[model samples]
Target chain A: MPLPSSIAALTAALSKLPGIGPRSAERIALHLVQSESGAVSQLADAIVAARVKVHLCTTCGALTEISPCEICASPRRDASLVCVVERPVDILSVDKGGTFHGKFHVLGGKISPLDGVEPEDLRIAELEARLQAEPIQELIIALGTDVEGDATSYYLAKRLARAGLKITRIAHGLPAGTGLEFADELTLSRALEGRRELS
Target chain B: MPLPSSIAALTAALSKLPGIGPRSAERIALHLVQSESGAVSQLADAIVAARVKVHLCTTCGALTEISPCEICASPRRDASLVCVVERPVDILSVDKGGTFHGKFHVLGGKISPLDGVEPEDLRIAELEARLQAEPIQELIIALGTDVEGDATSYYLAKRLARAGLKITRIAHGLPAGTGLEFADELTLSRALEGRRELS
Candidate 1:
């Protein structure tokens, strides 16, 4: 069915997502209209509600419905141990590991030199403020391993190391359950570099 | 910038497009508001316009802005020849080849036993009606090579053969530029089966 003007408008509006093209946007718009009347309305409601209800957590810059956010508000989380990440999606991955019970700080983006993004443009000022204000003992840099990630890590490491806080880099290695033969050269090399005594 | 309720509603609506998840939807919604406001509104207008203006061509079930569609209305196209396809996108591929200048019949979908889809569920009745009403000389079947596609093709072939039409199947072979050595088992088998002598 050809969509209503408003619906088509909405579809065109949706084409802005990271990878969605025009055809995909049209297909999605049609699917939403066809399948879920309530869901469509809910999505509309959510968009409005989220935009109004959600804001970046002032403490960590993570997108949240609440001011302090659930993680920040929780007393169970170790405020002394903080994990610094590049994005909110990275938080989900770290949480799934079930190893870390610390708080998080989202930098929003990495320092990309080619893309004209610099350290000053990111949430570095906020991060430094947190370090000065909070009684944090250890700061784990859980940033990505890209070229920009390396620059950001090195920059953050040098800055934080001067503060006398126990700063540590997240260990890099082959993914669990991945075959040795299928591993990329860089990952294999990293695994070899980080090897420990079996004992 | 904060989105207005109406714009947010539209953004939410657009995110449901195929391959678009939640994050992409927000990005798109934001993008639409920020840039190409006129073009975005026009896209919305097109959807509404298409919805109101376009209808299924009563002759072949292809959605068209016009009643019979340009292809169906064109006298230059072969009236006695028909190409059967699963969807409208398939028309682009055939059109790109610039080979077929005949009429088209959109079947909508193929029979999938596992999915409870049957021939009775599709446009088979309409197809039969078209064959009975028109003086179609050749029926060229162009469906996908999936199991469901094969089943549908075989069923259609048997039915068309019984009707005494000069039915032909689109030749199946390795995709253009794919190396013979890297060909999958099923593709290699198909290539061998569809082999021809250069007489």
Candidate 2:
């Protein structure tokens, strides 16, 4: 027999998540229904609370409970250097490295013609406005190394070059933990081209 | 830096669910916070609705929207037979076979002394009560193949055998899609011992 309407609804909602599929969604829904009501209610409340309270930082488009966010509001961070990323989650990825102390600007998404996403659809206008307002010395593009990322980077570099701003892209090379043998031809070639002199 | 309070709360709650780890929970929480308020609210509502509405059947302990559940309340099922399982989720596994037309009895959990779960902690008393009230002719033990499952099955069989009921356990053999080459030694031995005689 089919599951009850409530259970079915929970499963359908869970299936809309990023990684969860129909079977895993069903399992999670069943577990939640069978669990203590207090715990399930707490989870529901948490979900709603997060959605309601958390929003994008007006200054950088990073997710935050505050308008400017901690990073953008901080005076200690390098305001002259801005790292541009595609999404707010990418800020976390960059933060995990613990190297960059520069401020960030979220582009919201990349320029993907196949997906009907254009430059106007992203936060490029906001980025241009930030450049004009903030005393930014360098613009670091920390986007993906895919076709869309390359196209977006090229488009931005061409558009912003006239403003006499120093633009750079994060280097593409073999990842830190991986060996040369594991590196793809494109990565190996890029690493070779971007080789630095010994300190 | 740590995530915002609301995002952290949502991540913690999501991580409490089965199969979702810290990373997956973080991803889902971020996705929900970034999603439209209406969609997130719908998911939250679904969770609360399922938890508040779905409850255990009084007669069989199966999760249901009603008291007795669809299986126990239905008259078309074989009243003389009942399949016993460790959890309510196990009922779905048995139902997938589509051969068993009998009702089900959920034991809540298997007997595990190390974890402090005893026979009394399960729905064994409920099963006994059903045996006395219902016209059950056979008690099928569809528990797991592990040590806890074996102990629970043995204890139940011994305790309920005095009621003059035919007790049986599901056969252990090679799985349908697999070959003997993939079967382990114990499974091969059990399959050989339980070989049937064709008419």
Candidate 3:
């Protein structure tokens, strides 16, 4: 009457993943079942291996096979500058730009009262410890422009203001290749507020 | 400079799955790395378990935990009528209609010379063996309406004509919930040719 129990179980498990819907999960499950056993086994082994080996860097909370992560361990990186992000994945977005040569600090999540995520729930304590231990000159908050991200940024700014560090948020503006008509009012307002002199 | 070797390996492995592109694979890999170890472990275990537990039904070639599968083992189904399909997943689509109570025969794939899929490459021999063994009266070809499907259907019809069994294909027409404007010329032509008169 229904899909086989094993297939149904696999579909349910796949549906729990981000970006995977019920239909997509069912398709993937069916594909896996129909695929070669060796390929499926390899996928399973890869997942398990990644889960077992990858872990959050103790120094910056970024995902890494090593405790400190390569970024934290690299002496060439600017230790004086620390970029704070919401999750380990956010680090990849920043890293891909190849602009910043500083170290990173993953907050694990934003300060969302609705989601019951407070500042203490994040890796703020580890950040504070790093601030005290490292000669950090600036803290760049590279968080989302949402309400939660704003609240978290504001909270971090206030908490770390006494530490005599230069705190700044990434400038918001019309995205590249997007016209003014496509820009939302909030983004336009932020662009106006963050306008710099082009002499 | 690049992602950790383990993370990259997981991403590559995930990308190999159907419907999962490189970007989606990367996102899933990153999510797994960030997720609780228990949850990732569960997904891995589920994949392996499904791969290990599920096998092709010996009687009909459908995926099932059992060798014969429920459909093949059940006596309630019309054993005299066999519905031929391209893949095991196609059986699910037919079964969902809840109209056909006949047994299913998965050919694994259609005849595609371009793809190097021949009749011998499919489960045609097994189907012929079933025809000789079972009290099959009629065979319904429920394959896709593609060129390859038509070729396969024609081939099977010729091969099985000597057996004196009635062979019919599922009709092609304008799909439900679609307007004539959306119907292709070939489909419209088929619908016109297959039109029936009201009594």
Candidate 4:
């Protein structure tokens, strides 16, 4: 039998989320209906509250409740060493990795030529505008090893080059805690070429 | 860096669901926050609507918008035979299987001695009351092949047996579409013991 209309609506809405599939959506919908009203209300309130309160950080394009976001507004994070990423969500990954002590710039998306994503479609202009105003000494391109990512990084490095400004890309190699045997040939090549001399 | 307070709160709430992990929760929270306000509001509305509209079926304890539930009130289904299951959610699984055109009784839970669950803790009284009122000729126990499930099935069969009422447990064996090579020994043994002779 078909689920009741309201439960079906909940399942439909939940299945539209990033990782949830149809079966998972149904399970979650059923579970939610069975749960306490207070819990369900809290979940609903959280979704609504987050949507109402959160927005892109005006300065860096990261998600934030405030205009500048905590990273850009903070005094301890290195303002002169900025990491550039392809999407707003990537900002969270790098920050949560606990090693990057710099601010971030979200490019919104890569310049995928096949997908018609051009340089102008990205937030490169905003980065340039930030450069003109801020004291960023270096730009770390943390986009991945895809063709569009590489092209975007190179395009940014060339377009944003200035006197006393250094631009670098994150390393491509076998991931940490993984073996060399499973590393793809392209990644192995990149790892070999980007090898550094241990002091 | 930690997520913004609102996003963190949303992530915490989502991770409490059945299959969502902390990483998945964080990913979903980020995606939801970045999504369009209208889409987010629709999802919130769906959750709230489901919570507000749905409730347990007064008769069989299934999740439903109305008290009797669709199956319990349906005229086409066979009301003479009743199926018993552990939880209200199990009713959905059985009904959706497209077989066994019978009424249903939710036992609420199995008889688990280790977990301190007795017959009194279940909805056996309700099932008995329904038996007295309804013309239930057979009671199909669709609980699983677990030890507690078997114990509960046997207990119900003994307790509810009468001059005309027939109590039957669903089969246990290698699941359909599965090979015997991967089937555990107990499942294989059960399949062997329960084998039927084709005419």
Judging by lDDT against the true structure, name the best candidate.
2
Question: Model 1, stretches more than 4 Å misplaced?
Answer: A1-54, A112-115, A146-151, A157-164, A172-199, B1-55, B110-120, B128-135, B143-167, B171-199
Give the better candidate number (2 or 4) by DockQ: 2
> What lDDT does candidate 4 reach at residue A128?
95
Clashing pairs in 4: none
Q: What's the true lDDT of residue B78 in model 2? A: 97
- Candidate 3: list runs displaced more than 4 Å: A162-164, B162-164
Candidate 2, clashing residue pairs?
Answer: none
Instruction: Assign candidate 4 its CAPRI class.
Output: medium
Interface RMSD of predicted model 4: 0.9
The residue-by-residue lDDT of candidate 2 on A54-160, one tens digit each, is 99999899999988899998998999999999999999999888999999999999999899998999999999999999999899999999899999999999987
**Regions more than 4 Å wrong, model 2:** A162-164, B162-164
Between candidates 1 and 4, the one scoring higher on TM-score is 4
**Candidate closer to the true structure by DockQ (higher is better), 1 or 4:** 4
DockQ for candidate 1, please give it. Answer: 0.12
List model 4 lDDT by residue over A8-46, tens digit each. 999999999989999999999989988999999999999
Q: In candidate 4, what are the lDDT values of residues B48-119, reduced to their tens digit? A: 899889987778877789878888999998999899999888988898788878888888889998899999
Candidate 2 at residue B158, lDDT?
Answer: 93
Complex DockQ per candidate: 0.12, 0.86, 0.79, 0.78
- Model 1: lDDT of residue A13: 62
- The per-candidate count of clashes, in order, stands at 6, 0, 0, 0
**After superposition on all CA atoms, what RMSD does each candidate show versus the true structure?**
7.0, 1.8, 1.6, 1.9
Model 1 C-alpha lDDT versus the unseen true structure:
0.73
